[model samples]
Target: MATPTAVVVGVGAERGLGAALCRHFAREGYHVLVAGRTAEKIEAVARGLKDLGLSAKAVLTDATVEADVVRLFDEAMSPGFGRDPSDLVVFNAGNNRQLDFRELSAEQFEDFWRVGCFAGFLVGREAARRLVPLGRGTLIFTGASASLRGKPGYAQFAAAKAGLRMISQSMAREYGPLGLHVAHVVVDGGIDGERLLKNRPEAKAARGEDGLLGIEAIAESYWHLHKQRRSAWTQELDLRPFKESF
Candidate 1:
């Protein structure tokens, strides 16, 4: 029997949720394929995981590009790698730029959709192609509050995330009976990370103790989603800080 393999897209920084997911999956004994556009960052993350005696490799990729998405799966299933059809695939690539409704350009809106929705479709389709035959796999999409509601100045981000949410739901219905688990997770609070602290110091102060969402906790939830029995699969889940309203 081959070891399970996991693919994680959009591993932006060490402190972000994507990276956290990679670490958790790696610790669980899955050979993790870290996919992202930034070569340096992804490689650094892979190296760190390797240092911990975990199986990990960096696959520099732009998830928004069809060619790149295709290449990503090819590399994962390549003979040399000997990775079984990805046991877990996560579509975590997202573009969250706040633009006033009036200022949001068609191109900008499409860009978000390209990363947040189209890329997910590409990855999910490929993953299903492989998993359907084997009769098992898990696909997870990282969503946000925007996935549920559109806020002012976030027209583009909201639209894209909403599209992703629908895609996850549709896939869950279509593939659940085929032995594949598809889930969408909504992160509803500011994640406690260096980037968040640097950008919004006041948010940290306002959140109080355990007010910010911890990336590790989020990763743990994702692991739980993957381990769920077929009889009780979770199609969607929402995570937020204790202080978050609603």
Candidate 2:
């Protein structure tokens, strides 16, 4: 069998883990699509993949919009990738607007819901529509611990991601009969990004917060889930560093 293709949405230049996921999948010979709102960032990630002799493309998609999601799925299924709806579709795009409940505004709440749950819904539905026809595929959504428990200060982000978890389990049950696997990954660790590198040098220095679960680790878990048989399908997997407590 040829390498299965993957489409990763919600890529950001510096903050996103999606870029790393693209590199991982492409290295495995999958035709990867790096899609997000930033074209330049996506292109830069794709360029790195090309330099490494892998197939990848940069796509600009505002996942919050239905039309953009439609266009993305269309391009993903084009002849460039052997005309297939992706064997793996990952909706890793999320916007975090964490604010204390007392200080939170309606707009901030909406933003979180839109980017977290709405975007996942948009991407997941389209992936399901295409994969049902193909009769087998993997659809995974990235999640946070906040999604499972709405913390005191981060109500908005918690609610939205919680919605994604519910959606994932529901979709998993709905499509499992057709060989479509749906899994939600709860990334229960602090992500190490440039912000931590610059402002919180002490964290980088002292190895605080367990230094963010490496994107490669998360990507490998995705691959493992993808290869699982129907008899032993998993619905949710929570990932945290050794130093982090559950």
Candidate 3:
């Protein structure tokens, strides 16, 4: 049997959930394809994984582009990598910019939808194309609180996320019978990361040490989703800090 492979898109930041998920899957022996727009960042992540004696390769890809998304999957299945379809594909690409409806321009709104919704569709479609024939695989999308509700100053972000959420559900229904596990995860609270620590220190402090969602904990949930039996697949999951209000 070919060694299992995993592809992670939008792994630009070292401290982000995408990188954490890459590490988790790598640790479990899957040859990881670390993909993102920034070559340096993706390569650094792959290098770090290699340093730990895990198999990983960096593929610089802009998920928003159709050609790039195609190339991403092509590179993942190349002989140099695993030469097999990815057992797991995680679409972590998103743009979260808060803007009041009056201030949100058409360009800005389209940009968010292109990255958050369209890009995810491309990645998920490619994964489904490859996995359905083989009769097994896992595809996960990382969502945010905006996926479930639209609030003030979140018009663009929420609309894009909501689109992604619906797409995830549609894929799950269409492909589940074909043996693909499709799931959408909504992260309802702030993640414990450099961005959070630097920009929202007060929020983190208010939430207590464990108030922020741990990156590892989020990654573990993805791993769990991948491991679930077909008889009990989860179509959607919501994760949040205990202190976070609904």
Per-prediction TM-score: 0.96, 0.93, 0.96
Winner of 1 and 2 under lDDT: 1
Number of backbone collisions per candidate, in order?
A: 0, 0, 0
Query: Which residue segments of model 3 deviate by more than 4 Å?
Result: 79-83
lDDT for residue 49 in candidate 3, whole number 0-100: 96
lDDT of 1 at 135: 80
Over 1-246, each residue of candidate 3 has an lDDT whose tens digit, in order, gives: 566789999897788888999999999889999999999889999999999999888998999999999888877656363346588999999878678788888999999999999999999989988888889999999999999999899889899899999999999999999999999999999999766777777877788878899999999999999999998999999999888899
**Cα lDDT listed for each candidate:** 0.89, 0.84, 0.90
Superposed on all Cα atoms, model 2 deviates from the true structure by an RMSD in Å of 2.0
All models, RMSD in angstroms: 1.4, 2.0, 1.4
User: Ten-residue segment with the worst summed lDDT in candidate 1?
Assistant: 76-85
Q: Model 2 — TM-score against the truth?
A: 0.93
Better of 2 and 3 by TM-score: 3
lDDT digits (tens) for residues 48-76 of candidate 2 = 88998998888889999999999989877
Off by over 4 Å in 2: 1-3, 81-83, 195-199, 208-211
